[model samples]
Target: MLDLVKLSGQIPGLTQHLHQESKASQERLRRALQVFGRLQQEPQVWQSRHVDWGSHLSFTCASPAEPLENSRPKIEPLKGRHTVVATDGSQIVPNHHEIAYCSLINVGRVVLHYGTQQWPLLDSLPVLLYPSVELQQNSGLDAEEVLALRRAQAEVEELAQLALSVPRRRTTLALVDGSLIPWGLEPLSGQEQRLWLNPLLAALERLRAARIPLVGYISVSRSSETVNYLRLGLCPFLSCECYRYCNSDQAPPCQTFAPLPDRVFWGSLLQPGERSPIWRSGAKVLNPFGEHHIHCCYLNVSEGSVGEAEIARLEFPAWVAADEELLKRALAGVLSQVQKGFGYPVALAEAHHLAVVRGGDRQRFFALIEQELIRAGLRNVAVSPKEAQKRGGIA
Candidate 1:
C-alpha cells in the first residue's frame, strides 16, 4: 500500500539527518563523560548535598544509596543451591468490534532450582473477566491500556504467590521483566487509583513478608535517573531555582549533558558482571510504596567488548537494598541467571515463552468466543462492519 517510489526519494534526506544527529550525540556524550569523571572524584561531597526542587518540577533521578567511588563493584555469582523465580503475563483486551466485551490475562510462572535435583516448575494461569468492569469505568483509558494495567498487577501478584510458596531455607530471588514501579495510575486519583494499585502493593508486601529479594530486570534501559542527578554537579548557580530562573532561551550549564542516559555512562564504567552504585528512585508514584520504595543499579551482563556491554537496570525494594549481604547475593544470583541464559535471564525468558499469546492464538480465541455465542442461541451474533471488512481484506 505504501508508495516505495515516493518513499525512496526521502530516504537519502532521512539518512543524512540521522548521520548529523549521530555526530551531535557523540559530541554530547564526550562532554558528559568528562563531567562524569569530575563528579566521580569526590562522590562524598555530592552525596552530602541535596537539591530541593518544586513539586511541579518533575525529573527522573535518584538519591545515592552508596559511595560514588563504589561505581562498579564486581561480585562473583553465588555458588551452591539457590532458586530463581520469574513471572511474565500476556493479555487479550476487550474489543468493541467483537460480540463480547471481555478481557483475558495469562500469567506464566517459572521457578528454576540450581545445584539441586528438584525439577523446575513452569505454569501458566489464565483469568477471564466477563461483563468487564474496566469498560464501564470510563477512565479515559482504552481497552488495551486497561488490560495492560490489569496484566501488570497479575504478573506481580503471581510472582508474590510463587515467592511465598518457595521454601525459606533456599536462598530465592524473585524477578519480573521490567521496573517494579506501578505506572499509569498517575492520572487517576483517590479510589480509582487505589483500586488498581492496592493489590500490587499488597503483593509486594507479601514478598517482603516472605523475605525474598524481588528484582525487576530492565534490558537496554534508557532511563536517565543517574544522569539527571549528575546534572546537579554541572549546575553553575549557587542555588537551583529551576521554576523561577533558568527559563531563558540560553541553555543552562547542566544542559551540557542534557541528553545522556544512565546506561551509556554506566556501560563505559562497569565491566561484565559488575554493578553500579545503588540509588533510591525519586519517582512520586513511590510515595505510596512506603517500605517497598524502589532502588536501582545498573548491571553490565555482557562481556563482549568495551562499549559493547549489554547494560541492564536492576530494581529492588528498600529492604533488599538496606541489607548489604542480601543485595550482593541477589545481584550474584541474577548475574548467574544472566550468564546461563546467554545474556538474558533464563527464568524470565521461559516465563515469556509460556505467557506469550501469538496472532494465531488470538484468532482461535475470538473464534471460540464467537462459537460460544452461537451455541448460546445468539442468532444475530456478528462483529462490527469494520472488523468484518478487516478480516475480508481488500483484494
Candidate 2:
C-alpha cells in the first residue's frame, strides 16, 4: 500500500537533514562527555553539590547507591550451577466491537539452568477475565491500560512462583521484561491500588523473603535518570527558582549541554562486560514501594568492539542492590544469558516467543467466545458491523 516512488523523492532531503542532525548530536555528546569526565575527576565536588531537590516540579533523578567515581565492575564469568528464571506476558484487550466484555493474559515462563544437566523448563499460563467487580473498579485507567497493569502483575507473580520452585540451595536470578516499579498503578485510587498494587508488592516480597533477586532489563534505554542528577551538579546558582530566574526565551546556562540519554554516556564509560554503579530510581511511583524500592545499573553487554558497546539498564530492588553477592549473581546470570542469546537475554527472548498471540489465535479466541455465548442460549449473537466489515474485507 505504501508508494515507494513518492517517498523516494523525499529521501535525499530527509537523508541530508538526518546527517546534519547526527552531526549536531555528536557535537553535543562530546560536550556531555566532557562534563561527565570533569565530574568524575572531582569526586568531592560531585559529592558535596547542594540543590534543594524539593524546589523543582516533577523532577526525578538517580540517587547514587555508591560513590559516583566508583570503579566499573566487570561481570564475572558465571560459574557453578545457576538458574535464570524469566517471564514475559502478552495480552488481548477487550474490544468494544466484540460481544464479550473480557480480556486475556498469557504469561510465558522460562527457567534455564546453566552448568547443570537439568533440562530447561518452559511454559505459558493464560488467564481469561470476564466482566467482574475488579474490572468495573474505577481505576482512571481505561480497558487497555487495565489490561496492561494486569499483564505486568501476572508476569511478576509468575516469575516469583517459578523462582520459588527452584531449589533454595541453587543460585537463581529472576528477570522480567521491564520496570519492577508498578507505574501503571500510580493513577489508581486506593481501592484500585489494593486490587493491583498490593498483589504486585506481595509477589516482590515473596522473592525478597526467598533471597531471589528480581531484575528488570531494559535494552537501549532512553531514561535520563542519571543525566537529570548530573544536571543538578552543573547548576551555577546556589539556589534555583526556575520560574522566577530562568524562565525566559533564551536557553539557560545548564541547558548548554545537550540532553543526551544516560545510556550513551554509560556505554562509552563501561567496557564490554562492565557495569556501572547502582543508582536508586527517583520515580514517584516508587514512593509507596517501601522496602522494595527500585535501583538500577547499566550493564555493557556488548561482546564486540568498544564502538559497538550495547548498554542495557538493569533494575533491581533495594535489597539486591545492598547485598554485593546478590547483585553479582544477578549481573552474572544476565550477562551469561545475553552472550548466549547474541546481545539479548536468551531466557526473555524465549519467553516472549512463547507468550506472543498471533492474529489467527486472536480470531480463534473470539470464535470460541461466540460459541460459548451461543451455547448459553443467547439469540442474534453477532459482532458489530465495523468488526464484520473488517473480517469481510474489500476486493
Candidate 3:
C-alpha cells in the first residue's frame, strides 16, 4: 500500500527518483554478480570444520578485597553429579516481526533445552527467558526501549542467580548463549562504568567467589557487529552470505555477532587473574584496556566463512503491515542472495513450493510445502510443511 502510494501520488518525486536509483543499484549489483560468478567457479572446497565464532564474550569483575583470605564456599550442582547445562533465549523485536533471542548457560545437568518448537527435547528450560507481554511494549522507544531492555536484563540476571547458585562440583561453566554485555544496549552514558557493569561484574564474582566457572557459548552469525565485519569485508548490502536466495529450513551461524576490533570490552568491568585481560580482535600486542587477561576464556567464528549459510530455520520477522507481495520481494532479494551463496536453486526462495499448488486447504498447503522439500533436496521431509509451519510456530 505504501509503495503504491509512493509510486502513485504521495511523495510525488519518489517514484521518479526510485527508477534512476534502482537502475544504478542494478548496475552495481551486476558488477558484483560478475565478481561472485568468478569466485564461485574458483573451485573452493567446502570444509566442515567449525567456524571460529566471533561473539563469545565474558568478563570477571574486580573482586572486592579478600576478607583476610575468606574461605571459598562449596557450590554444588542441582543433581549430585557435576554437569554442564546450556541455556538459550529468543527475543522478538517490534520492527522485526519476531526476535528469537537465546542464551545458553552451562551448569549441572537438569535437562537443559533452549530451542523453539522446531528444536525438540531442547524445550522448556527452567532458565529460558522469552519476551513476556510486560516487556513487549515498543512505543516512541526511549523510555519504553530502555524499560523493555531492563526487563530483559533482569531476566538474564535471574538466570545468572540460578546459574551461580547451582552446585559446582568443580568449576561449573555457565555458558551464556550470546554477548555478555548485551549488544546495542546501554543508557546514554555520562556515568562511570560501575553504573552499568559493576553489578554484573559483581554477579559473576559471586560465581567466582564460589569457585564455579562460567563460559559464554554463542552462535557466530547472531552478533550484529560480527555481521557488520563480514558485510564490510565481503557483502555489505547483503544481510547474510548464503541464505540470500531462499527461505528454507536453514539458519545462518550466530556466533559471528561480535563488536568491532577493540569494542568487545571497551568500557566493561573485569576480574583479574592469570588470564585477566581480554584481547581485542586486531590486537597485535596485548592491550591493557579490556580485562581479557582476567577472564581467560573466549570464543569466536572463522574469519573466512563467518557469513556462510546454515541448514536451520532462523527467525527474522517481517514488518507490521507488509503485504505478501512486498514481503516476498524484500525477502526475495535476501533469499535470492542466500540461495546463491549456498549453491541452492532459486526455486527454493521464501516458503514457496516446487510446483504451484493452488489450494488454501491445509492438505494442499503442506503438500506443496513437502513437494518443494523433496525438490529442494531435503533428505528428511517427514515433517510436513504444515507441521513445520506449526513448528515454525509464530515468527
Candidate 4:
C-alpha cells in the first residue's frame, strides 16, 4: 500500500543531502577536537572554577579528570537476593468525534528476581479519563498537554506499586525508561506544572523514603552536557559578561564544539561494563527538584569493539548519588540486565513490549466500544469518515 515509485525518486536526493551534512559535521568535529586537546592541559583548579554565564546559561561542567583518560571501574557482581523493577507507559489519545469523550493510559511493569528462586512477574494497569468540567477545562490544556499529564500519572502510579510490592529486606532497584526530570513542564504555565510535576515528585519522595534505588535509563542518548564543559574551558574572553552576551556575530571561541554529542566522546572512552563519572545535571527544568537535583553518568553496554559500543545515560537523584553503596548496586543491576539483553535493559524491554498497543488491538477495542454504545440504545455508532477511509485503505 506504499508508493514505492514516488519514494524511489526521493531517496537519492535525501541521501545526497545527508551525505553533505555528514561531511560538514566531520569538519566541525575536527575543529572541536583541537580545542578539546588544548583545554585538557589546563590545571584542575582552573577547570573546576565556576564561570558565570548569566541566568539563562548553565555553569555545570564535567569532573576535573579527563573523562577519556580515566579507566573503567570494574563491574560489581550482584551480591545477594535482589529485585529489579522497571515501568513503561503507552496511551490512546482522546478522539474528538468518538461516542465517548475520554482517553486511556496503560502502564506496564515488570519485576525480575535475581539470585532467588522466585519467578519474574509482568503486568499492566490501565487508567481511563472520562469527560468532566475539571478534566476537560484544566486551564484549557491542549491535546499534547493532556497526554503529558497522563504519562506522568502513569509513571507515578507504577512506581508506587513497585514501592509497595518490594519487601523491606530486599535490595531493590527501581527503573524508569527515560529522564526522571519532567521535561514536559518546560513550556507550560505555572499552574500546569503544579498539576503534573507535583504527583511525580511525590512518587519520587515515596521511593526515597522506602530506601529504594531509582534510576532513569536513556538509551542512545545525544546529550552534550560533557561537551558543554569542554566549551567552557575554551572561552577566551576574560570577562563573564562578554561570553554571557556573545552572539553568532560576536562568535565566542567555543563555537567549534557545536555538533559534538556526549555519546561520541564517551563511546570512545568506556569499555564494556564501565561507567563514566557522575556529574550534576544543569538542566533548567531540574529547578523544581531543589535539594534532590538529578545527576547523570554514561555507561557502555555493548560487548563489541570500543568504537562500536553503545553508550547509555543513567540519571538519578542527589540522594542516590551521595550513597556510594546504593549507586554501585543500582549500576550493577543495570549492567546485569544489559548483559542479558545484549545491549539494552531486559526489564525495560519487557515493560515496553507489554505496554505497546498495535493497530489490530486498536481496531478491536473500538469495535467493542461501538457494540457497547449500541447496547446502551445509541444505535448506528460509527467513526468519522476520515478515520473509516484510513482503516479501509486505498485501492
Minimum summed lDDT over a 10-residue window in model 1 is located at: 49-58
Higher-lDDT candidate among 3 and 4? 4
TM-score per candidate, chains pooled: 0.92, 0.93, 0.31, 0.88
- Can you give the lDDT of residue 344 in candidate 3? 26
Q: Provide the lDDT at 245 for model 2.
A: 58
- Model 2, 275-391: lDDT tens digits are 888888878777678888999999889888666899999999999999888888899988988888988999999999999998998889988988998999999788889988987
Distance from true location, Cα of 306 in model 2, Å:
1.6
Count the clashes in each prediction.
Answer: 0, 0, 74, 0
List model 4 lDDT by residue over 231-326, tens digit each: 665556664444356774655665575766777777766887788778777666677786567888888877787878889999888888888888
Candidate 4: worst-modelled 10 consecutive residues by lDDT: 57-66
Best candidate, TM-score? 2
lDDT of each residue in 169-196, candidate 3, tens digit only: 4323344334444332333332322343
Error of 1 at 198 (Å): 2.2
What is the Cα-based lDDT of residue 293 in candidate 4? 78
What is the C-alpha local distance difference test score of candidate 4? 0.74
